[model samples]
Target chain A: MSVPNAQRQIDMLTKMLRIREFEERVKRTFTDHPGVIRGHTHLADGAEASIVGSLSHFKKGDAALATYRCHGYPIALGTDTKAMMAEILGRVDGLCKGLGGSMHLTDVKKGFLGTSGIVGAGIPHAAGAAWAAQIRKKREVVFCFFGDGASKQGAFAETLNIASLWKLPVIFVMENNGYNVVTTSAQEDANAAAGQPLSIKAKSFAMPGVTVDGTDPLAVAAAVGKAVRRARRGDGPTLVESKVYRLSAHGNIIAPPGVPLHYPEHEAITVFGKREEYEAALRGDPVPRFRGILVQNGTLTAAAADAITQKVVAEMEAAVKFAVASPYPKLESALDHVYA
Target chain B: MAQLPYIAAIDAGIHQEMRRDPSVLYFGQNLATTENHEFVAAYGHDRVRVTPISETAEIGMAIGAAMAGFRPVVELYMAEFMLVAMDQVLNEAPKFRYMSGGQVKVPLVLKAGFGFACGWAGQHTGSLTALFMGVPGLKVVVPSTAADAKGLMATSIRDDNPVVFMHHYLLTLEHGEVPDGEHLVPFGQAAIRRTGGDVTLVATGWMVNRALAAAEALAKEGIQAEVIDPRTVAPLDLDTILKSVAKTGRLVVVDQAPRHATVGGIIAADVVEHGFESLRAPIIQVNARDTTVPYSEPLEAYVIPDEARICAAVRKVCKTAR
Candidate 1:
């Protein structure tokens, strides 16, 4: 439960940089290689520190499930970015054989079980996996990720109650990005409107609730690491409200086939006209903020950070090339996998 | 073989799988509340425990457990309870294997009872077989006998897909000879309850008994009817119905659900499209009246398909000529 050492800190920063770079490529795909990616694509540029830190404690036997803002978890879990990109581009070599697009990226082999496009639906699914882990008696845990909006869903309440009652080994990580699509948390969430942290809702279920600065990887790691240990010890589930800001709009503008799709400006500026708030979030963007902290603390040198950045940029660049060059799946293969 | 009630046969099927596969889990609302409960006694609490009245979590947990390499049978008790968690039942459980491109198999069973028309009233007495039968990735099983109940439940557990095993509430205590052990009835096969030449009677679940009684009445009237019970509706045995139609040259479909929601309508459409030449008469469908089943006994009886309705439909089909 102690702070991650220098090596682990550098590793966490590397992962955050990879996620930021991968999300940038996905955003650029709208213009750089128009029409290559289809459907709604959510970006995880701002939540990288929280994602990487929580998953840093992941082990071989553990499992993780997340919302559609899913690209970051797999990257931290060591999934092949090439296959992930191919999946987003609907290619034969895709992670899910092109059947599941960006929203449903899954790598069971890597213990990244799957993602649910619907808000709050995947929460109970994580508890279900935790039940399996409990039955296995291996002290393994499950990490369940969703947004602050998902906390309003009935699945969240039902699952939290049952998870605590059964003492299921799962962590409910709510990334409070301040918005559920275009609606702000204060508009939709009772706790937020009352000026209470969303984590306070967990008290009703009789489990520990903690709020952390999601923009800091070390903070998230420390908080989530304690919960992981408690879960491993069969204590019960915990609810961690990791507060972060989404760097992009909820997703690319949804449109018909004839009209082109693209990512719009963040709702802070576009919908709420709060340019100053958006500017503040941009200045505190976790990816660069973590890098600056590492340099100031002497855990990482400028040259080392730059080298890591160059490698991740080249890695993602190759992923885009490979994905664009990959061929579409066979038309008839659509009929496959309808039944197992 | 041994004589067992429909409910016990279903339990036998579950016990059959749970005994062999330690990974098979049976849990639901209010079933295993005590340690001495039958399932918890046999399999222990790790594999059997009582869940809260959270349908969404119950089915969703089953899907997650299934993905993690365990076969879970969620004891839903009533099919209408599934409506409370349609997203998990319709979207999540069935879509995982397909959306994951076969990378994960959701091998689980949703055991729910349907068609309890004995004064249970509208909300509790619906025959919702057709609602689940048409979902692409779901397998819907409607067993009409104790033997088929044990066998189909076994097969549903073994099948590597999401299965909705809809057992009729009226048949909970109906006794029949079930196989002693390892009884597994394959899906997508029809059971010919009776064979005749004048008309073919196609039905499922409780309607099969009504169709059989109607066939007997039709036999006495010199209009022989062949009764066909399609055990599993999703992987429907259309070929058997077509072949039966070819021999009888007349078709009569009886369903306990409303007219539009009847699986018979789907089967009738398939027959008309695929076996039009085999029919000497227009297919007659005898479905329940399109209304909520009333609480009154007579009104409920009038709303549901009965032996008289099936016999009337069969006789009507037999009267038509090529």
Candidate 2:
């Protein structure tokens, strides 16, 4: 690749790598602290590039709505990593004030409407946001991200139809990660989950639908950029299916599942291997690669890269410490928050 | 002032509010310009939006607008339709303020009609005030008189939280004097429409009228029942209820919803919890029987709370106290 192109790839990868490393750390931090979060924690450790690429193009005021496993999107949207980590720890300073914990992270000020714990529930919310923006004559668009599992939900199709009908500026980004928790999308019982490609489903809405290589951060970024531009021009909603893999067990197993489990280790490893190879073939990391290219192109320098990373790390660390030092919420506070 | 039904008072309030604030908007099925109702003509198309058949999406749109700082009033047309938009009402709107760390305010008013009148059948006449009251963040209002209807509707529209304003289909034609001026009926305060000393008759929506009628009948029998109109179910006027229960030492709750999850149950539970020591008798609840509201007028009348049931419950509570 040319110096500029290689640099771009590197910058993207670094962000991806940061997400991957962050999730790994979260799992490790919580291993001994089993009481940190009750219920399930779906990590996005391996599916970093897809989120990094997709979020790269989101403007400051643009909205993002994602499914329950939504750590990566907020991280990409400039939320502090420590706060997210502390949220997993169920500390008061967490994004949702330790109330939502792992599966639901919401920061309205950051333009993240909050992640829905319900499958495909966020789809309608994103469409609603897009509709509001359109009615208010605001230029902002909303990006709704969900897994292939969510694509089969009734709300998903309903929202897609409405967005297209209203010509709302919304982008539906389906991350086809093959598995939804334990059951693979192919084995899901729903008729909609039956043999049709997702992009083809989007086409049924009479809207533009395309599939992209999710592992290729640049490809994902390019797809998002175009869709965003089309939406801003009032071309209506688009469904972009990013083909990716769940490199880890749906959550926290680290290795692939045992044979008795529906999602066998062989299939898991094979899918995981594809992501690993792509990640390895690229050199120096996406961030460094992009920074180096930027220096060569006279846009940024190696010193600036160090400065940006340092500032971001410090900011993230401060959020973590703040959450850790913050007092636990009062027991009575639960009553006040739920109803008001 | 002429007597107007509860539904007419609500319509009047909505029309008045829209005329007062251009930012205030209303949306629902058949509530727009196409209907050619005087309300739609006065509000105009810009403020009066006609929505498609997607109830969930419509409610979601209202919540989104409220989040974006637009004061939106959404009419569900029927309480049954609220099921489709339960996620938006219970999950999103209520959680917005706390979930966003008190950063966002959802100034959305969701209005619905409930209760059996004509043969609207099972789906059309469910009084969901009790179900909605169970939700922590929402304010549930059920008005009886036209004055309370207009005053409470104005208060709900101005309140920051998501308020569910339920009007009985029966009350649409029923009339009562409504003050033709600005008035705010604060929630959590009960109206002692008819005061007495023998027993406390707690009621909501149309049941308030039934309770009063029952009280009048009981008055002839020297029962002297006190009729309390809650008006708001969520910020329930528990203080007034407990005070009345303390004085009368007897309680009877009349609700239009089913027996299982009735507003009657909540009031009874509250009385038992707080007013148990002061009680001179076991609490009684007059609610819709444990069956769906039937389409046949006879079956419907037998199932829902009526003046007969209210009178019987008042007599029962009075007997228990004696």
Candidate 3:
């Protein structure tokens, strides 16, 4: 839409790249040195722009419930990158005090209710947060993100149905990475007799449902912006499905190679002119694209942009060092946070 | 002082607590307005609420509201219905305090009526009090009489921890005199119904009455049976049972729950573990059969623990006492 405000677009793209870069480092660290930290790790590899764009629409105090693949949302929502890195390292300095580890990172101060590992478990919690806002007569919207598999959960439909009926201010952002774990929608359908598009399921609850290109941050931002406005106006919940691709394995640690193209990873391959042509496109990273836009708009300079990127990189590198140096949580602290 | 019936005391406790505290509000499936609306008539519609039969969401909403600093008394029509909101109650409520690193105190009271009553069949009647007792950080109370219900429930409502109070629907019709004015009975304390020199009869829930009745019958035959009522099962009044067993030299525990690992199992295990030295004879446990509470009147009678079973256990324990 009108290419967005040049400054806003820059901010959105910067945040998206920050997520991509942060996750790329996590992948490298996990692969290079195994057993430093271990568990079911789900990183947002291909779905970067979708999270950054949508989350940028809401301010501090508006809440969000993210799924297992939640590293990006908390970072974008202003949780300390150091604390987040510490969490992945299972250090006591981590967010959730290292109690939640990776999948359950939460910064209540930032209004990020903890991400849940159980598929669709956090949907009702998001609805409850939105319901709380309505009861308090506060103009706050809650953004709930989950994967395609989670959308199939009963809690998803039940929560959406109730939220629509109650007119609660909640936005359900379904990040359809074209697969649920190793199984695609096509395989899921062939496995099960009932073959139906999941977006239609969202519409069945009387909420407006639409799909958008998740790779395109601007499109996702526009769609989420509309939903946020609608919710702020008390028009009720909206379901927006973002179609994207996962560049890495479903989890942070990839299975041994020769796993056969799980789902349709190679199906929608964007072909270039030649190997040299592809290398040329790879040089045009989103960081430069964003920096060039900000400079042209006069909101920033090329030199100032370089300084910001360097600062972020330094901060992130320091965070990585902090995590590597930090010790894991004591064994006794394991049962410490079971209640609160 | 004459003891009160557990059901009537529960109703009175809820009524008095609501009147005393303005912040306390109540809601459930048929709480405010049933066809007769007995629960609301005693409390009031503002304080009492009726919901649209959403067991899970209703409990979840109440918990969320509690997290937002509202004291809510949620009524789960039956203890069996608690299964619907088990995740919210077990996962969210208990886990919140620890998850928040002791920042949250779910001062939420959940009222659940358990135990087999009438002929409501398998689903309607099931005593899951012992089931909740297994969960750490949750306080469970099985009040057997009106007085115990009033006092224990009052303490439960004011306690910082989340409490699941179990009352039996059959005892709702059983009335007894309750002391007026504020009287809070401490939890983890047992009520000694009868003092005897022979054997100790440990009981909880409706089984307390049966134990007392059996003790009365045993008294005529010179089989002195000391009947002990464990008002709250979770923070069990173990000292009382141990003391009674120490004196009487024998023990028999009667619980309405199934015969598997239950309150009876807990008492028997704890007594043998802690009070075995003073015991004159091996402990005996009388409980419901190892199955669901059947619907048929005769079959239900056959499954649930009764006075005959309690008396038989007492007689056998006393006869075996060295």
List TM-scores for all candidates, in order: 0.99, 0.87, 0.83
List model 1 lDDT by residue over A72-179, tens digit each: 999999999999999999999999999999999999999988899888999999999999999999999999999999999889999999999999999999999999
State the C-alpha lDDT per candidate: 0.93, 0.75, 0.74
> Stretches of candidate 2 above 4 Å error?
A1-11, A32-34, A189-195, A252-327, B1-3, B20-23, B33-47, B181-183
Which prediction has more favorable DockQ, 1 or 3?
1
Query: By DockQ, highest first, what's the ranking?
Result: 1, 2, 3
Instruction: Compute the lDDT of residue B10 as modeled in candidate 2.
Output: 84
lDDT of 1 at B42: 91
Where does the lowest 10-residue lDDT sum fall in candidate 2 chain B?
Answer: B31-40
lDDT of candidate 2 over B81-172, digit per residue (tens) = 88986787788777767765565677889988887557888888887888889876799988888888898988888888889999888888
Candidate 3 lDDT over B251-298, as tens digits, reads 998888887857888989999999889888888889889898888899
Residues forming the 10-long window of minimal summed lDDT in candidate 2 chain A:
A257-266
**Model 3: CA > 4 A from native:** A1-8, A187-197, A252-307, A328-340, B1-25, B31-53, B103-107, B150-161, B178-197
True contacts kept of 1: 0.67
TM-score of chain B, candidate 2? 0.95
- For model 3, residues A1-340, the per-residue Cα lDDT tens digits are 4457767766776677677767766766665545556666777866777888789787766888787788999778877888888888788787766666677777777877656677776677777667667655678888989987877666676678777877888899988876676566666543222654456665678888878887777788889888888899999999998876666557643445433212122222332124443344335443455456568878677787777677777777777888888887788987774433
Best by TM-score: 1
> Which lDDT value does model 1 have at B211?
90
